[model samples]
Target: MKENSTFAPKANALQDYQFTIIVPVYNEEENLPRVEKELLAYTKIASKKTGILFVNDGSKDNSQALIEETCTRNEGFNYISFKENRGLSAAIKAGFDHVETPLLGYIDSDLQTAPEDFNLLLEKIGEYDLVTGVRANRKDKFVKNMSSKIANGIRRAFTNDGMDDTGCPLKVIKTAYAKRIPMFKGLHRFLPAMILLQNGKVLQVPVQHFPRIAGKAKFGVWNRLLGPLMDCFAYLWMKKKYINYEIKSKGC
Candidate 1:
């Protein structure tokens, strides 16, 4: 396989089967190798056909090169690099756009969420348009954990998605519904609500969490607390004004 090559084997278990896992990466060079190894292991044991799509959000570090090298060596791994740094939402949206698969999934490169637990979400994919991981035991600083808890509580009170961990990186979503979601700066936080906008069902399962073994956290007080607070109002506006319709008649 050539460096930066994008090739994934088609699965034989199911006819027309395709599942893509998108890992949005930014300056996570230290974690890429471990992420690659774990993801490859998970792909082997995944319930359905699987491949990896890494969205390089213009990391200043060696993340892109590592991603390219991994994709070149691993047939199941593929990647796309951005020209400049964009936030996590942009990377995720880019992944959703490029993937051609029945099922689309995402996990952060931070290693805080175990990739193996993706199977926990995938097991329930058949029943829900979105299957999200609820971090069973979050491993973070007290401040970060508390801030996230408050943010999640506020989100649930407003959006009513009833998800305990919308911020959890591990998720499996049906691609058809995922593509219809409107993208915004912080829209990644509202994934469950966006799926709910389409009247799609969402399921949450308990998944393991771990401490970040390397790199710095991308989010701070502004993005974690105040940012989400502002985005909640945006979601409210979108919820009220967002349009959804169905065509009941066939074209002649």
Candidate 2:
């Protein structure tokens, strides 16, 4: 394990911090090295205590091996591997189940969203239970972009979460609120809405986006469009039946 350092190399100064970035990856062998490098660089510059957790979503490739190798070489990097191929939501839920820090964050393994922008989300963690990035200028294909726009519109109309880009993978959430969310297949798409159910505040910030430099996109038309449509109805049903309350009196 890498010793947790309190001193920054650039400033040679000590600081207080506590947060974890959970990266759910599926067959991302080609991008692991770069991901490790960028995350390490970000951790060094981060103003808080930071660590990286890679959740292997039952990748059939050598992703698990590479994840172990990277963690072995990097002190701040840790990981958990699933036995079978669960979806992104399951991976994220596992991350939340295990995270012990005050704040939790996530980013995609494809490198489309910059890891450094996590600092942008972290800046507002104190004011919001969840802070997510809205891709400023997306570089995805027209179909993907269009589908996401329509899906987000439908999601907003139904859930009324008022978030413009729920698909953006970069997010920093307070661990307590994150752990309370119910896990489901497409629940990752409804994070902001789920947070709102907990009476938690969510803030969206403009973050940088880039064209994918490596690997193929995991989403298809069905997963991005049809899947979200069905999930929306599921969310509506849950929202209507959901229960919340406050205790006015208690005896100890």
Judging by lDDT against the true structure, name the best candidate: 1
Task: Please write out the lDDT profile of model 1 over residues 19-131, one tens digit for every residue.
Answer: 88999999999999999999999889888878888888879999988987898787667787887777888888888877788998999999888878878888898989999
TM-score of each candidate structure, all chains considered together: 0.93, 0.91
User: Model 1: which residue pairs collide?
Assistant: none
Model 2 per-residue lDDT tens digits across residues 125-163? 898999999999899999989999998998899898999
Q: Rate the local accuracy (lDDT) of all candidates.
A: 0.87, 0.86
> What is the RMSD of candidate 1?
3.9
| Deviation from native of the Cα of residue 179 in model 1, angstroms | 0.2
Per-model tally of clashing residue pairs? 0, 2
Q: How many backbone overlaps does candidate 2 show?
A: 2
